[model samples]
Target: MSGGFKDAKKDGSDPAGTSMSNGHMGIREISAGVAGGKWSAYEITEMYIDKIKSMDDRIGAFLTICEESARAQAKAVDEKIRSGKQPGKLAGVPVAVKDNICTDGIRTTCASRMLENFVPPYNAAVIEKLINEDAVIVGKTNMDEFAMGSSTENSAFRITKNPRDVTRVPGGSSGGSAAAVAAGMVPVSLGSDTGGSIRQPDAFCGIVGLKPTYGLVSRYGLIAFGSSLDQIGPMSKTVEDCALMLEAIQGRDDRDSTSYRGEYQQDYAGRLSGDIKGLKIAVLKEYFTDGLENEIASSLNESIRRLEGLETSVDEVSLPAAGDGLSAYYIISSAEASSNLARYDSIRYGYRPKEYADVDELMEKSRSEAFGTEVKRRIMLGTYALSSGYYDAYYKRAQKYRKLLRSQLAGVFEKYDLILGPTSPVLPFKIGERSGDPLQMYLADIYTIIVNLAGLPAISVPCGFSRDGLPIGLQLIGPHYGEQVLLQAAYALEQDLKLGL
Candidate 1:
C-alpha cells in the first residue's frame, strides 16, 4: 500500500528498485520529456519495468511482462526523436493493458486456464492505436477470468491487491490495470467495463477511469464479455491523462461493426479547462439508497457542494427502473458471455481434455476443468435463461427492463447534462470477504451497472477517502456520446475537490 510513486524517497530512489524521479512523472511529462530530448524513451521504459519487477510481487497486477518488446519500442522512439522525426502524441509513455485485450505476438490470457497460452496474432484496435501513438506497452495485467467477476479474486492466476490497502481487493475484471496505475507501475493502463469493472476498481484504487459510450472506442480485438455492454477504457492517475488516453484510442474502426460512425472530438485533452459553469447535473436518488456507506454518501454530498460552487446546478432526480438494472444486466451479459465463450471449446483452440472417451465428454471435461466457478455459474444461468420455453420469461424480460432503464436515463439527460453518484456503495473490501457470497459481490456493482446497460459514457474520479483511509470514487454519467462535456465536468470537479492522491 505504501510503495507507489508518491512514496518515493527524498534521495530520488524508489523502494521498488527504480528511479523515483521519472516514476513520479505523469503521462504528458514522460511523453514530452522523451520527445524534447530531455530523456530517452528507453530510460522511462526501463524505470517502469524495474518498478514492476520489484513491486508487482505484492500487488500481482501483471500477468505477462513484455520487457523485450517494450524495450525495443522505446529504443525505436528514441531513434525517431534523434532523427528529428515527429513521434506520436503519447511518445514514450508506458501503458499496461488488460489481459483480455489482444497484443500481437504477446499472450492474451483472460486470467483463465482456457487459452492460457493463447498468443494473439494481431493487436486489438486500441492496442494498435496506442502503439501508433508511440505508447510503450509494458505488459498485460491480470483480470477476473473471462471478465466475469466483480473482484480480482476470480482470476485463475493471482489476486490483485489494492494499491491503497494491500489486504483489500483492487476491484474487478480490470483490477490488475487499476492496481498497476494505483501502484505506479505504469502511468496509464487499459481496462474493459462490462458492468462496473473499470469504474469500481478505479474508485477502490483512488485514481481516474473513464468508460466511453458504447462503440465510441473500437472493440474489434477485445475478447467479448457482454457484446452490448463491453467497452475498453482508460485508467490513469489524473483526469487529464485519462482524457489524453481516450483521445488517442477513440475513433472509428472499419473492422468493428459496432464502432461509432459519427465524428468525435479530436482534442479531448485540450478541452479540459475545468470550467463547469452553467452545467446541469442530476443526482440519481436510487444510487444514494440504503446500501451506500455513510462516508461515501457524505463525500458525494461534499462533491455536489463543490460543483455548485463552480456555478453548476445540482438536483435530485429519480430513475426508478435503475433498481432493476442489476437483474437485467446479469441476464443479458451472461447470455452474451455464454455465446461468446462458446468458441473456446476444446475442439477449436482452447483447453483440451487428455482422456475423454468421446467428443461430448471431451468438451464437457475441458470446460468443466478450465473454467472458474463464477464463470460456470453464469454460463449455467444464461443457458437456462436462453433455453427453450424460458427466453421470454428471463431474456426477453431483461431486454424490456434494459429498454425502460435507458429510456428513463434519456429523459433525465434531456433535462440535465450529466448524472452524478457514488461509483461504489462501499470502500474496497478485504480480499475474500465477499467471495463466499455471490449476491453480495454482485451488489458491489449496483451503482455502476446501469451506466453500462444504458450504453452511456461515465467516469469515476477520486473524490475522498473513508474513515479507514480507503479511497472513494465519484461517478459522472454523461449522455450517449457526451464524453466531451463529461470529461470537462469531471475535470472541473477533480480540480476543485483536489483529493491530492
Candidate 2:
C-alpha cells in the first residue's frame, strides 16, 4: 500500500484523483495554514468551493453548494484573526455536513424528494459546534433518503460514485460525505451512522470515519431515521482530523436527553499518545467468513501483523451471534423508522400533494409520490413489524436479539481493549451493481452494523487496498465511552502505515 501511494505520488495522481498534497492534507494542516496567514479564511473557502464546482460533477458528492454563506463565514473568521483574537481550533478550515443534518437557512435534502426544498430552522447541535469552532460549512453532501440504504444508489437525487473508482460506489448512506473528503473537496465532514452508514462509507472511500459511542454527540436537528440507532460522527481524511472533529462536536446539549452529560474527555487529538504497546486487541473470527472477500481477508491479516509488529497482542475471538447483526439491525431500525418517519404527513412541513380528497388522502398521496422506492420499502417493513400480532414476532424479538448482541460485545470488552475486524464484508461494488438486490447491499455492512447495535465507539481506518486498486478498511471498535482508546489505536495504525493520504 505504501509503495502504491509512493508510485502514485511520483505520477502526481493520488488514489482519489487529487494531487498527493491535497489528498493528504487534514484539518490540522488546513486550519494552521489559514490561521498563520499562509492563506486567508475566504481564500481557503474559495479554493474548496471552486474545487467542488469543478470536480463534484463527476463525483456527485454535494447536493447543495453554500457558496455565499460559506464566504460570509470565512470573512468573519478572517476578521476575528486580524483583530488579534483567536478564531477557534477549526478557523478557516472548510468542512461539509451530511445533508440529513439540519443547517439553518440551507436546504438539507436527505437525498430524498420529500424534503428536497426543506430548509431547517435551526442548526444541528454538531453544526452549531462546528460554526463556533470557525469551521466553514462549504455545502451539504448527498446521502441515502432518510439514511436507510447501504449504497448511495438509494438516493433519489444522484448516485455518489467512488472517488477511487468512478464506476464503483463510495458506500452509503454517508457516501457523499466520504467521497467529498476522499476527493479533497474538504478536509472533514459530519455524517450520521445508524448501522454502519458512516464506517462502511469510510471503508469504501479509503478514509477515516468515527462513529462515536451512542449519545457521545447530540442528535438534535439531525433528521431522525432510526432514532435509537442514529448518531452523528466525523468523517475525515486522517485519524488526527477525525479526532479534532470529534473534539469540536462532542459535548452535552440541553435539547438532547441522550447527549452525554457527565464530565467528558476533551482534546481528543491532543490525547493521542500513539502507544498501543501491549494493547489487547481481539480479531473477530466470524468476520472472515465465507462471504468475506479474499483480498480483504489478506489485507486484514497483513494489518494484524503490522499491529503485532507494534507490540500489540492480537487473538481470535468468536461471537457466535455476530453473524445475526444484519437481520437484527434491519428489523430494529425499521421498527424505529416507521415511528420516526411518520412526521412527513404533508399536513406539517414536507412536500404536499396538489390535490387530495381528505387529510388522510393528502398524506398518503404526498408520501407515495415523494418517497423513493427504498424509503417506501422500509416504511412498509417497519409498519408491518409494528402491526398487531407481528410486533412480538419481529420487532420485539429483534430487540431481545439486540440486547444479547450488546451483552456479547460488552463481555468481550472486559477482556480486551478493542475488537478489530474488516469494516465491510466485501470490497466496493460498482454503482448500480447491487441496485436490484437489496439483500446483497445490506450484507455490505455485515461487519460494521454490530458496533452500532451495541452502541459502541468504532473507527474505520485505511488498512490496505484490493487487487483492483480500491481501498480496504480496518475496523477498530471500542467499549462505550472508549473513544480515546479507539482514536489512539487508529492513530498508531495510520502513523505506521504511511499510505501518504
Candidate 3:
C-alpha cells in the first residue's frame, strides 16, 4: 500500500482526468503523452523495465520477462511515431501479456516444464492486436500452468505473491498479470480466464479485471485448456482501462470459428454514466451462503447498497443449479483439457525427455517429470472423464449440466439486468494454506466457474476491504455480450466509493 490511487490527482489542469496510479496509465494518458510528445513507446518500455527490475524479485509474478523483444518493439514504435505516422490507438502504452498467450520467438510456457523451452513461431491473435495497436509487450506474466488452479501456487515456475500482502495468494491462473499490475510494474495485463483467473486476482489485488463475453474476443493461438471456457480479456487498475483494452482486441477472427460476428457491445465508455436508475440487480443467495467470510459478504453488500442510490433495485434470487456449475465445470473443462493437451506429445512440441526404449515409457516419463501436480491431477481427471465407459457419466452429464446452466443464466437474465455476487467466497489465503487438499483450493472458484460455463461477460471490482486489510470484490454478471451494463454498473460504484476512479 505504499502507493495506491495516489489521491486521484486528476486536478483541473489535467485534461485526461487521470489518477496517479503507479498501477497503470490508461489508454487516454498514454495517447495524450504520445500526442504531446511527452512520452514515447521507448520511454514507456524503459519505465516498465525499471519497475520490473526493481519490483519483480519480491513478487515473483512473472514466469518470463522478454526484455529485449519489448525494447526492440518499443524502439520501432517510436521510430514510426517520429516519422509523423499515427502509431494506432495504444500508441506508446505498456501492456503485460499472460504467459498462456503465445508470442512469436518467446518461450510461451504456460509455466509448465513440459513447454519450458517451447517458443511459438506465431503470435496469438490478441498479442498481434496489442502489437498492431502500438502497445509494447512488457513481458509474459506467470500463471497456473495450463490455467488449471485457483491460486498461482500451481505454477511450476514460481508462486505469484499478492502485491497488497505478500503473504497472501494472488488468485490465478492469471496471478502474475494481476500481481504485475497491482505491483505497479505495468499499466495493464492480458489474461485468459477459463474461469475466475482474471477477475479473482483483480479482486485479490484491488484492481479491475474484465472477462469479456466468450466469443467477443478471439482465442486464436491461445494455448488451450478448457477451450469452451477459456477467454482472453483485460486486467488493469480501472474499468476504463479494461474497456479500452477490450475495444482494441475484440472483433471477429476467422481463425476462431466461434468468434463473435459483430456481437461486441459498443459505446462501452459512453455508457458509464454513473447512473443505473431502474436497473434490476439480483443478489444470488447461494453466493453469500456458508463458505463466504462475513467481511467479504458485508463488502459485497456495501457495493450493492451504493447501487441502490442510482435508482437500482436489488432482490434475492435462487440459482439452485449453480451448485452444480463447479462440479460440471470441472468435468467438462478437464475433459476438454484431456483432448486439448493430447497435442503436447513428444512428436511435435514441448519437452521430450530421455530416449526411452518404448513410446509408452517416453510419454510416461516426460509427462511425469514435466507436468506439475495440479496439471497431472487435471489431466488424469480429464482423461478418465473422456475415457470410454465413463464418458457418458462424467463428460456427457457435464455437457447436459452446461446446457442447463446456460438455461439457468438466461432465466436469470430475463428477470435481472445483472446478477451480483462475491467473486470468491473469501479473500485470498496464504500461499500454502490450502495446498494440502486440492479440493479445498478448487472450492474458492465456486462463484466464478459458472460464468465461464454460461459464457456470459463479468467484471470483478474492488468494492471495499476487510478489517483484516484483504480486498473484497463484487462481481457483476451480465447477459451474453452485455459489457455495457456490466461496465456501467461497475463505473457507478467506482464513482461512488471513490476507490480508484
For model 1, the stretches where C-alpha displacement exceeds 4 angstroms are: 1-23
Q: What's the TM-score of each model vs. the native?
A: 0.96, 0.96, 0.94
What are the lDDT figures for the candidates, one per model? 0.90, 0.88, 0.84
The digit string of per-residue lDDT tens for model 2 on 251-284 reads 9998988888787898789989768899999999
Which residue pairs show backbone clashes in model 3?
A: none
Please, what are the lDDT tens digits per residue for candidate 3 over residues 1-501?
122223323221111212343334667877677756776777667666766776788899887777899989888888888888877788878888898899999889999999999999999999899889888888898899899888888888788899889999998889999988887777789999998998888888888899988999999989999889999999887888888888888989999998998756655775677888999999888787788889998888778888887789999999888876888988988888988987777767888887788888878778888989888888899999988999999989989998988998899999899999999887889989988898898888999999999999999998988888788888999999899889988888888898752
Clashing pairs in 2: none
lDDT of 1 by residue, 308-410 (tens): 9999999998889977688899999999988888887787578887899988898899999999999998888888889999999999999999988889998
Model 1 worst lDDT window (10 residues) = 11-20
Candidates in descending lDDT order = 1, 2, 3
Candidate 1 lDDT score relative to the true structure: 0.90
Specify the poorest-scoring 10-residue window by lDDT in model 2: 1-10
* Clash count list over all predictions: 0, 0, 0
Clashing pairs in 1: none
